[model samples]
Target: MRKKALKAAFPHTLPVMAGYLFLGIGFGILLESKGFSFLWAFFMSVIIYAGSMQYAGIDLLAAGASPLYTAMMTLIIQIRHLFYGLSLIEKYKSAGKKKPLLIHELTDETYSLVCSCEPPKDVDPSLFYLFISMLDHSYWIIGCTLGALLGSLFTFNTAGIDFVMTALFIVIFTNQWLEQKDHRPAVIGVACSAVCLVLFGPDRFIIPAMISIALILTVFRRSLEKEASDHEDP
Candidate 1:
């Protein structure tokens, strides 16, 4: 069962594997350039695992930011995961002992794949999701470790490497938009973000945009689900 689930999950994660590897390497290079060791890269990839937050953390660590500030920044940057968790509450509820790991490993790429992909008839859905998460996590760990080793061994230009993450996100968003018949969620997110961007400027808009997206999605959940189901029908 596990083997079958793994086979089914791997194809779905190929895109994520490519993205995470590049992004992870970029992160490692950036962190190493900041004077941290490869061990720091390996451990941070394992423990932190939040891509954007980890990138932000390089600066925080360099500046020796206060714990309170770190905690607040961590919350602000990662608060989107709260919404991701809410969406998966039902799908993951029956995962039993694996639920905790699933939640911990749920990065944006993992969430996008697991939320959209269904297991084969012969595969257990929970195991499929687990394998997907595990595979993606491993790719990131390996990539970060490799990058750190390379950084230690050689010198290379590191400018503009951080943009890898933004590029990955654009790919994921484009893929999701193409796959889903219901574009309301995407439209709502963009509209809210645009409005918030205009009202609050870039730095202050993130929280407000997320809040608006969550509330609007909640209020229209039933209708959106119904529309999604209708589109799925033959």
Candidate 2:
């Protein structure tokens, strides 16, 4: 069952693997250039797993930022995960023993894949999701390790590499848009985020945007579900 699940999951993760490898490599090179070792890259990628936050974390660690500040920054940056968790609550509720690990491993890429892909009927859904998460995580760790090793041995400019993540998000968003018949959620998210960005400025906009999105979705939950049901029926 697990083997079948893994086989089914791997193909779905190929795109994520490509993105993570390059982004992870960029992170590792940046960290190495800052005098950290491959160990740091490996551990951070394995443990933190928040791609953007981890990149931002390099500066925080280097500056010896206060723990409180670090905590706050991490929360603000990762606030969207709260929404992801909310969406997956029902799907993950019955995962039993796998629930904890699934929650722990729920990075943005993992969340996107899990939300978008369903396991083949022959494969166990839990195992398929687990394997997808594991594969993506492993790709990141390997990429970071390689980049750190190369950086330590040689020198190269890694500027503009972080755009990989932005590109990945754009791709994911586009795919989601194309796949869905109802554009309400996407439109709400973009409109709210743009409004917040203008009103609160970049550094302070995420929380407000997230709040607006959550509230709007919660209020319209019944209608959205009905729309989805209607779409599926026809």
TM-score of each: 0.86, 0.89
Best by TM-score: 2
Question: In model 2, how many backbone clashes occur?
Answer: 0
Off by over 4 Å in 2: 152-164, 232-234
Model 1: weakest 10-residue lDDT segment is 153-162
User: Taking the tens digit of each residue's C-alpha lDDT, what string does model 1 give over 1-234?
Assistant: 888899999998887787787778878878989999889999999999988899999999999999999999999889878878988988998899999889889998899888778899988788999999999999999888887879555456756655655665677779889998889999999999999999999767889999999889989999998998898789
In the predicted model 2, the residue pairs found to clash are: none
Write down the lDDT that model 2 would get: 0.87
Backbone clash pairs for candidate 1 read: none
